[model samples]
Target: MKKILLLLTLAICSWSVLHAQDDTFKKYRENAAGKLKKAENDTTNRLWKKGATLSLTVNQGSLTNWAAGGDKFSLSIAGAFSGFANYRKDRHRWDNTMELAYGYVNTTSLGGRKSDDRIDLTSKYGYQIGKSLYASALMNLRTQMANGYLYTDTSDIFVSKFFAPAYLILSPGLDYIPNDEFSLFVSPITARWVFVLDDSLANVGSYGVDTGKHVNTEYGAYLTANWNKKVTENIVFKSRLDLFSNYKHNPKNIDVYWTNMLTMKVNKYLSANVSLDMIYDDDIRVFENKNTGVLGPRLQIKQVIGVGFTAVF
Candidate 1:
């Protein structure tokens, strides 16, 4: 009887220890699951936000034995895309944006021509320094997608091509953001590199690059301002302005780039857009006329108006 009791007592002690260990493991698992569920439910801790907008406009016209003095058949298509990805956590922030636009037109008279082409990308990182202020670093790239030509009465002249005249700018600056709709960035020390990858253009020293060189470097002061706002329930406006003054060259002649876009939402899928772009680079030379045979710097302007299908994502 004593031996049997001793054996039973040892068995009972082992079972108790096993049960206690299982309870402890169950509690730990429950705690971990609760923490994970809380983290999943909390959107305030989300680190990244992204959005994009797309627009496509198409125009077609046909003339059937009509004396309107127009092309027999004409078609034009324009597409634009804008997107942004932003991250914010604690005092650190990162923002990236991309914009692309291209347009093509084909007609009986003009044959085929490119109306517009643009590619722009920007990335910025900042650390909060004070209320509505940040110490930031920014990098920007600007280029075109296709070859550009200058049409003349005699013949078309080859001008720019993909990566032929690309601009890359890097700056460490201060950004002021008092509101969500507007921001201004300024930097006294900025480095800008102009790349002319085409051998022909580089040989001619196009776009301020040295003769026979593919890249030109400049030290400059840079300023950029951005604004985006809803003018009304259906209308939205966006604008950006950039200015740069080269310290090694003619600092008095500042480079200017400004663009404005106004969008009116007609419905969920239809919209109207008006865009204006202005640029002035002292190094960019333009031919005055065929007769004058003079090339000089001039202000360039472009305006576009269209109604198109719009999508947001």
Candidate 2:
């Protein structure tokens, strides 16, 4: 009887060991299957690819009264069409981007009927400086077509002349992003030189008498801040502020300006924007009159509301 009990105990021990081994094998198989499925899904979804965007904007506005008279108020309409294609590698680097934009505007003011058109071509190369830091440089070629008249008084009239000016600007800047969607950039130096393709407008001064050849080489500093927040799955809030100052040959002849824009993204395909721009020029004010010379601060303000369609590919 004692021998029989010992044999039964040994059999029970063997059965328990086999069951444990079987359970361990089953778990290993399940884990391996899960890993294989994940690998297949990753292969099917290609997350690294190139993208493109096309956009259009239309805007209209009027100026209210304070001083300077021709028409008590003015009507202006403007539109812009832009497109870009870029190849993104990794999270913060891109090789290059091809950007093209065309803009046109028409204005009827107290001064007279005015119109302007511009074509801009830009190419950019970007590099990642660090985890949340990026550096980029852009080359731009711009051509402008303008026709207008400036009325100093009821007696003084300046005729409109059709002219086109072309220039190339080189801009390099660094960005500091604390998070995924917020960034601030401070570029202490930027240089802009006009090639002087055409000298038609150089010798003619409508606002003041021609005082020989005026220099137009501009060197400046610029600062920009951008914020992007997701309001919903399909909506977003975007805001940007850009400030710049140009110091030319004459220190007092500097130009200071600021532009602020807020955009509400209705969807991936549509958005609306409100923008404000201000420009102050010391030289333009100094040469206001050919004889007396009114030298001081000159200010101009602009406000606009616009709707646009944007597409990304």
lDDT of each: 0.94, 0.56
lDDT by residue for model 1 (50-134), tens: 8999999999999998976788999999999999999888999898999999999999987899999999999999999999999
lDDT of 2 by residue, 1-313 (tens): 9999999999999999999999999999999999999988675454334456566675555556746644434444444444444445565443333444334455564433433344556555557778777787656565445543444656533333332234455668886767757767666677755433334445653222243343355677655565767766655565545554565455444454454556677877897766666766443442254565754456756666767876766
Models 1 onward score TM values of: 0.88, 0.53
Give Cα distance to truth, residue 84, candidate 1, Å.
Answer: 0.4
Which regions of candidate 1 fall more than 4 Å away from where they truly are? Answer: 1-35, 38-45, 289-291
Poorest lDDT segment (10 consecutive residues) of candidate 1: 284-293
Runs of candidate 2 with Cα error greater than 4 angstroms are 1-77, 95-122, 140-143, 151-167, 195-198, 204-215, 218-220, 226-254, 263-273, 281-297, 306-313
Candidate 2 structure, TM-score to reference? 0.53
